[model samples]
Target: MIKSGITDSRSFPAVSIHGDLVITGGGLSGVCCAITAARQGLKVVLVQDRPVLGGNASSEVRLWILGATSHMGNNNRWAREGGVVDEILVENTYRNPEGNPVIFDMVLLDKVVKETNITLLLNTAVYAVDKKDMATIQSLHAFCSQNQTTYTLTAPLFCDASGDGVVGFLSGAAFRMGAESQEEFGEKFAPSAVYGELLGHSLYFYSKDTGKPVVFTPPDFALKDITKIPRFKTFNAQESGCKLWWIEYGGRRDTVHDTEEIKWELWKVVYGVWDYIKNSGNFPEAATLTLEWVGAIPGKRESRRFEGDYMMTQQDIVEQRWHEDAVAFGGWSVDLHPADGVFSEKPGCNQWHSKGIYQIPYRSLYSKNIHNLFLGGRIISASHVAFASTRVMATAAYVSQAAGMAAALCIEKNILPADIFNQYHIPSLQQRLLKTGQYIPGLVLQDEQDLVGKAVISASSELLLTAFPGATQVTPLTLSVAQLLPLDKGTVPSFTFQADAQENTVLEVALRSSSKPGNYTPDITLATQHIPVHPGHNVLEIQFPVELETAAYVFITFMKNPLVALHVTEKRVTGILSVFNSVNKAVSNYGRQTPPEDIGMEAFEFWCPQRRPGGQNIAVQCDAGIHRFKAANISNGIDRPTHQPNAWVADWNDPQPQLILTWSQPQQIRYIDLFLDADYDHPMESVLMTHPENVMPFCVRNYRIKDAAGNILADKKDNYQTHNRIYFAALVTTDRLIIELEHPSATVPAAVFAVRCYGGEVGQQL
Candidate 1:
């Protein structure tokens, strides 16, 4: 290599790249957006300022990703965000069950690089925006410190997902940084000035045990007195990394311009806390522990929120309001933190949950001022109160996926972003998102192009819910537990349960259901029974004197009784679960949420499911079987369970389960999409928590597709994902198709949510 002579001035190498869509962040939201657009035939350029993707989820920050499921702490059933984000999360669970942050980084990188249509720029920060006109961005100018080069990225559509809305700021997009007044949006839960108008930044640290004593020397900048932190007493030797999410700072100051100051303050807090843990002699167990990693950057919570066509508010979330142009959904509680962060005497956070998942409209995704600009992640147009719920990584990714799809439609129709809704294209957009496994609340796929609608579907056997065989396991009734059963409009069925009582006691049993059919709140009590139990064994007969007018999920609740233990079954099925009315400290669930009357938050009990290796169903037997799982449900257009069990579940006793689809005439078929069960109730946190199993227990591990002549078209093995798309080498003309499936486990039944067939050109698998 030849060295150039020093001159008065020198410039770094300049490069220009062009694409159909340009995304300005590499967080989960931006990564999902890029992948979605790229799959929909749009050339995408993903520009990330950091060395790795996942932003706060990367090893540098190490915050676990959470969304609607809220660690399975609320009533939102089967509520995980789908599409590209689901794929990433599912894949991460399959490959990285240990949830190592560094492994998560590799998963994101692998997904982005696999998409040929996506051009990813790592360690590149966008500094300048070039406008084609007053309201449209023509290109962006970015500099990569590692490469020492400047890049000019040009695209017709741009998505600003940077944590601080960097592109939106440079492009003059209208944005709000602080919380709005209570009167501005009529938000009763809006924070007052004393409580702080903005959320703060958080830094995390990890510690390791060396089996021997380790010395810790405090830095000059380390905080001297840990007592200054009000909640310092709550810290313990076992809690490290994101478990100490309360260690936050820099909310009173400008979060964007003063990020460095905020990070330094957070650093001081972390080092000082560690100093107290290691040198304070308070934690004897931490004597052999050493600092493994400390976050280099703080995880930002609130920043500049760019304005779009519509702004989501508190009422939209609390009321679970429906949107005409709904594209995404959010279910996390409205969680807010104090501006003083760790130093404040106030509690760590204020979280208020809604009864059900709320729909996000398409109007809140694009910048109103900048014509070609799309706002994503925490920067999406939403009031401060609403942003608290939508700011989570999974929800952000779900919303960003919609924006990416809208961008693709813009290119295909040669129209602007707003024109998509104005021209009655929202239905088409919704269908496309559904095809890719994106779940919009209360929406079902209605694609007329799918040939499955024209076929008569039949299954070898359908599950008749009569009983869940009891195993050797028996769980104590420490907290109230309920068995969720989907029932039709009729008299409640008589159920029998096997229970063991330590002493003679009266076991209170109640039948309940959600006021809203689609939700799982279990707020309305239908009937109650006080059953007298014996000391050793009891076969309790539960009969409710109630009749239902409509079909819904009824909850058979057995109230908390320390003296009783109920039998639990190992048998797992689709659209069925056992929930408990208890506290999940991780999500702020405290048995029942009793918010202030004027806060505009609902007061209800939290009925949530437990995770695997323990969340077994309660053993029950019924006189009349509930036949809800029908063969025709495979073509019902709904992918996940909603108000009813919208799935075809085979009986557990069926030796070889199969589904056959027969048409009137021979038709050319090239593609088939199978939607299976992936246990959506599990939160599947991206990092810091280990999952029990790599594959979801309800997914079909092996399946085969055969044509009319019994020739195998596709044979899939060890499938763990929810969406399975099969493409044939060429078009095959057949009047009938048979799908043979193997259950994921002997105890779990084989279930399918939907099966869609299409006649199209064969393409590479996505």
Candidate 2:
């Protein structure tokens, strides 16, 4: 480690280029392995040939990451690990609210490189593997395109995530290709025949945003192909938040062998399809879309794979069978395109059918013949029938993360890749998985210890299931009483009740409400019918048929639109930033071209230190020199901000701009994070440094801060760089705090930052 006093400014690598785990292929699987290993605090080197991450889904290629979330209509269930897959959800859910491809790729790259334990090599490809006996991969030789250099990596465990089982093939691992007869895997979708052909690949494109038109040019052919117009409607000229273009599936031919040709053909169809639409005057709104992504990537739907200890079959997926060491799940169906799908005689017969979530055994990920090697993504051991159920991005991510985590564990234990699975500690290792918010729905433990335990309903319809060390069932309890009152049951639930006749005319009962403050609700009601009934934790939601009298303290309950969008902008600040839109109840996240159609889960979130025992707020963050409180246009102020979370702003000036904060934590929070700038041009409220009533006296020197009582609280010089941040500590709870800032110059109008609260601090664990 560099000495703090050295003061030398230089970037350094985290691990040796050669280590105990050499993961080949930079696709989703390889990236997942890199992420999982890093999170486990293991040294991992992630190599990728592409300049940017995300393989086929990268902005450079332009494909939405369709994970298992859409498995109902297709064959795409992937069972493996959830660590990396969940990270995608977490990152996209918050960072790129619009699901921007540029941001998505950036996020993937950042997650891989930012891990202190990971060494990420971009624009590099593993050319060959040096083996120490056939059972182990000794070193991998890789060439970096940009640097014009070669690098070698040595790892005890190696994962092939090239999406085509490239590592296994290069290492001489046993592999298989081509479709098998239906009897081989007992699959309804699999023909009773074997075929040399493969499923087709799609070249996806989309518009920049809605409400904009860009004249599109068609193919170079003199005459247009008008005969095949309706055949493309289900996928073409459709618009919702944004429009998609040229969503064509081609390449019924050998995908890998014809990758380059497929990409070119896909593009030709792209312009040709648009031309047909423009000339025919079909899709009156045809010109309103732009070709944002021309699908430059060749996503091979079928390819080479290492034969694993267990070859996953259609039966396993159909039965949802979980192995003792099961790490992933799948649900996409067996969707085999006709061998000549590009010129099929029949429509839709090009797509075979199978449905329901399927289970993927962990053994399917590693090579049965190759000792140290593992595979992920479309390259894993799946008979064509089972591969159909695992090809989606989500399932791929799950499998990749599991392989990565297993690799890391193997590196640490100095064991072979198969050792982890064979050991009894698999459950504990899986426990490491569950703690990170990944779900193992059908995990069957070899240790006879079960993770399923008492399930409790979270304030919102969220579930807070507890993991019982070893238990069978943990049902959620629901409030199922027909009537309960001081006179009816034991005693009426005592509390001051307020009813708004104008808002919620019908009184309704609620299951539970979040204690996250600002989220409290008097009229929040969750319908009992819709909420799944967990055995033990169901909150009864009974609603009154008619409006309740003002005098009648409600018997039932209801969920009403918040008078205004209410959320804690910053959990660590001492002031408030309000957004009360007169037009709508919610605030649209600006900057994001794609706004969510629904509110609710898309609700805003903030981070701060956790509350301490004395009921005292944890910290206070504020802007110092020149910052003001301004509410741009927040719904004409129907109500004033109350129980307001505070905010801090950074000056537009100063060689170093910062929003200074100070707090005392006796403990920590689960996670600490901050909301990024959404770029709402007309922000409802600018962040401010309010003078609190019980303010602490503090002194400032240059940029350093000191408590009036003479204790060093917080400081800022030119040392810290800033974009926007709410610093916090995990497992650390703070007490009273003081916040200040420095608006260095006039060019910097009052720096605007908002929503600050005091709570335990945490970071993005996902």
Candidate 3:
């Protein structure tokens, strides 16, 4: 059928495209996949049928982005999706807290366009696929309505992130729709028998007050008798936007085939509801209120869920079942809606939350029969009950990140996607994910090439000599004296101390060069100063100049003020000045800002002891056993919470805790990643809630990097939050390098999760 293009052909001209990866759908999941893959240096073609990106969360649907944390409710706590999804949440939280759908569209657009490797095709709907023996997809044809062009994109791999499972359907991938029988997955919430009816679609509207009397007129299509709608009995003019998620339809029929009918019905409901508010004369607030926007397309919920290598079940979520190949996690509740949607006489949806979070295995991301087909978003392989929780945009984003990374690795290894798991290739995959800041619960990364694992470890403070677990109980104690320091400087410049203020008050501090430098307690008061402080746990510093030539011991003392209290611990170290007993009174652990409840005395030591049970030394020094803070743990890649606590902590005397990586020979290192334990105590909030203190108080405020020759490489200062990873400007070859950290807060000791170095090996990137 080859015809001369100059005269004989009047048909639509076809365009051809090629890439390493082709993704169908432009929702949150597809966008995440494309960004991640393209950043890994892969050519990606992201095709979407919609005019704008962000599927249901787009301007067309206007649904708010909801995710695993369940709006920070259900005690899910800090369980927000932390990878690419977190990038969106953090950026949106900082840029668009008011939650404007239009602004969100721009945020997503900016993220996609910034990646040079991604070729985004908007308003291009893929309706057909070319498959190789029904096992692998070779290419797909899409029609771009905006440009009136037909494009065929070919790739080695394909992902069906389209919410409706359109690509999978054309490829003939095994899929299920609607509710399943209770006996199928043993799901308590499933219907007694299988049914094709599915969860319906929802429409939303935005309204604002114009501050003037506004008139209203109802179209003929508007529902005249609003009393027929049951949910409207309590509806008022004040409701609109996300508050109206209950405005739904199309669950009782084919969701895709009946989209027009569903949209028209939703229109009637929306206009009818507005008519009642404006003309029914029931509410006075409607007199000046005007409709800002109404969603043109309904945000559809449940649809075709393609079958994968493994299917997630409700039992797995409820029991928090562990998976060997787990690549992501979900904390959202098992949310299921009625087949009748808004018209249902029963409640719209039923939900049950998990105790914490459940694992999502990689097996659930690819098609069971198709060789190169992977899935993301709501269409991922799962039973109806399991799909309820994983369908949220945030949770789906994590799945997309995992799939994208896996695809990159698959291409690099010249292996099929399924071989990544079958051939025991998960360790490398997991490590790469963690390096990119994708956190997986209970997984720890161990670097075999870290030369610091062979060095001798030592510190400047003697208060770190306690056992790994430290004291079993907190003891009440107090400190009257502190460590003596011998410095090359003739004068003692400055020092910081931790104190708990019973109220807003001040504590008097005195520093003296110890006549007896070997003594732990203050021998002589050289200088006395008064320091003003605030309530709560605080680290305050005092500066004064007291010249003392030759070797000197600095003795510090505090006035016995009841308004301020210092921390005491049983953990002890050597070769540095320490605190001496000032007062001993047994007090309950209750009402204390910090913990080690039984260890606090009337007088306390300057060094704070963190409770850690398991860690191995990375250095060979005799005092290495005494220095409980292992340097190797910095890059072991386990991100534990403050309560569960897996962190490397140094004594309070040293402002800089340095991790030195040394080798017998030079080691080439081009990248250094530092994961600081940002004291993850507070839950992640999806709304505009601000805390009195910055997030992760224990995170380093500033730092400097130096090589063995004492050359400064990089000095980062005044940092907030945590650095996922920092790449060096160029490769450095040396016997050793050091990372020195400054405490973010005076009260707490510096904590770090991992310090990772990358180089010396080929192909080390995503």
**The best candidate in terms of lDDT:** 1
Give the alpha carbon lDDT tens digit for every residue of 1-766 in model 1: 9988878998999999999999999999999999999998999999999999998888889999999999999999999999999989999999999999999999999999999999999999999999998899999999999999999999999999998999999999999998999999999998989989889999999999999999999899999999999988887888877888999888799999999999999999999999999999999999999999999999999989989999999999989999999999999999999989999899899999999899999999999999999988989999999999999999999999999999999999998898888899999999999888898988888889899999999999999999985455789999899999888898988999999998889999999999875889999999999999899988888889999999889999999999999988999889999999888988889999999999999999998888888878999888798888998988777788887889999998899899999999998998899999887888899999999998999999999999999999999999999889887788989999999999788899999999999897767333
Candidate 3 lDDT: 0.68
Per-residue lDDT of candidate 3, residues 627-663 (tens digit) = 3344444555565431123446666667567766666
Question: Per-residue error at 677 for model 1, in Å?
Answer: 1.1
Query: For each candidate, C-alpha RMSD in Å?
Result: 1.3, 16.7, 14.1
- How many residue pairs clash in model 2? 74
Let me know the TM-score candidate 3 reaches against the reference structure: 0.73
* Candidate 3 positional error at 598, Å: 45
Cα lDDT, model 2, residue 307? 80
Ranking by TM-score: 1, 3, 2
How far residue 329's Cα lies from its native spot in candidate 2, in Å, is: 2.2
